[model samples]
Target: MKGVMASVQDVGAPREKLQALEKIEQDIAAALSSAASALQELSKDKPAQKHVDSHSTAFIKTLQEVENGLSQQISYLSQVTTSQPHEGSSYGSQKDMHMAMHRSAHVKSRLSELEKLKMEHLMQKHTGILRSYSASNDSQQPLTPHTPQQPHTPQPHQQPQQQQQQQKQTREQQAQL
Candidate 1:
């Protein structure tokens, strides 16, 4: 009779352990389902993130480069203005030559102003983007990174010696010309 009672007690102990394990498994399943639903919500917004990233590239850089190109063109025009052609081109009157010179100067000045404004615009945009990314870094968002680092790093500051050397070279080239 005592043996039978001991056997029944052992069976009940195993049954209780099984029930506890089953409850744990159910709880884990519920947690996983909740996590999965949140992931689905995040996935819905991915396309919009893609759009912003597409626009976010050195986009301002390309714009700045264009402005630089325009500035170079403006500089060329200035050079042309400063250096008069040795040979004369036919002109009807002193007034006509004056008008043509005035027109060229006006165009050069306008372009310089436009290029300056464009450079400012590009700079403002670049700074704004930098601030936004710095803020994003502070936000501590999930690791779903939208941007990948490029192989080439962009540096804003030029070395003083390099700049001086470049200036020297430019002066030499101009002197030679």
Candidate 2:
């Protein structure tokens, strides 16, 4: 009876841990979604600097949360896998080990995705800052007085009669010479 009770408790323990990991994964996914939405909003045409700064800060905070959640998931998965049944040490069933490995792989993929998103966010933020700086500079510059442009000289095609008379005179002079 004692051995059976211990076996049941051991099985229940890994299940509870896996449930906790799933909860964390869900939270991380939500954070990533929020970050993505913020990026989209920031990409809209001509947002103010104040809005950009606030969005960027929010994005950074969400990213940090996702990273922290991934770290915790990784550490927890490591513990589960390392303590798995091996030659008589009954820590968890093979199913638990497989699940932990699968979860670890998923977390790693999410981390890579998070890295790509971070790079995109940084680039967006940099471009926004540059645009605002250039816009501010343009607004501060004094406008120079407009001046009328000089009229263009008429082409030969546009003054055909004058050109023809000049050509006729030149021919007459050349014939006399």
Candidate 3:
């Protein structure tokens, strides 16, 4: 009788240990899943950062190019405007003078347009950079706990008395705790 009792106790102890191990595994899995979800949420910001960086670099390069073009255009316009038409020279025909004047005016208009465009581009780029900085700062904030709050739903067949009883029981349990 004593040997048979000992064998049963040994079997029950192993079963209880196995149950505890299973519960621990379940808890670990839940923690890992939550961590993975948080990582995925944070990863979404990387592409946006890359996009902003690329645009900033491109904008600076393009603006430099526009400035260079504007300078060249200004020099060309000055050269056209300052040249004296030779007196009694065939190259200084009335038509040639008219054409030179028209070219100078066109160049000046283009230079004005380029300046305006550069200003607009600078404003837009500055705005974008500021927005990106704000967004980056926001993204750096720590993630909040992701536990989903579920709304309580009563069963269709449950009576009002049953609901009241359930609520009472819950309150009593909480009071005990």
Which window of ten consecutive residues has the lowest lDDT sum in model 2?
Answer: 143-152
Question: How many clashing residue pairs, candidate 3?
Answer: 0
> Candidate 3 has what TM-score?
0.26
Candidate 1 Cα deviation (angstroms), residue 144: 21
Best candidate per TM-score, number? Answer: 2
TM per candidate comes to 0.29, 0.33, 0.26
Per-candidate RMSD vs. true structure? 45.0, 33.7, 49.9
Alpha carbon lDDT of residue 31, candidate 3? 47
Model 1 lDDT per residue over 1-177, tens place:
565334323333445535544554554555455445445545674545544444433344444444544444344344345663312223335657899999999999999999999999966765565455446553333322122232222235966655554444334333332
Query: Model 1's lDDT to the true fold?
Result: 0.48
Counting only residues 3 or more apart in sequence or on different chains, how many pairs clash (N, Cα, C under 3 Å) in candidate 1? 0
lDDT: which candidate is best? Answer: 2
Per-model CA lDDT versus the true structure: 0.48, 0.57, 0.51
**Ordered list by lDDT, greatest first:** 2, 3, 1
Worst 10 residues of 1 by lDDT: 143-152
Q: Tens-digit lDDT track for model 2 on 1-177?
A: 565334334334556647655765776676666667667767889656676666667667766755655565565455557874323335567668899999999999999999999999966765554454445543343322111233223355746765554444334333332
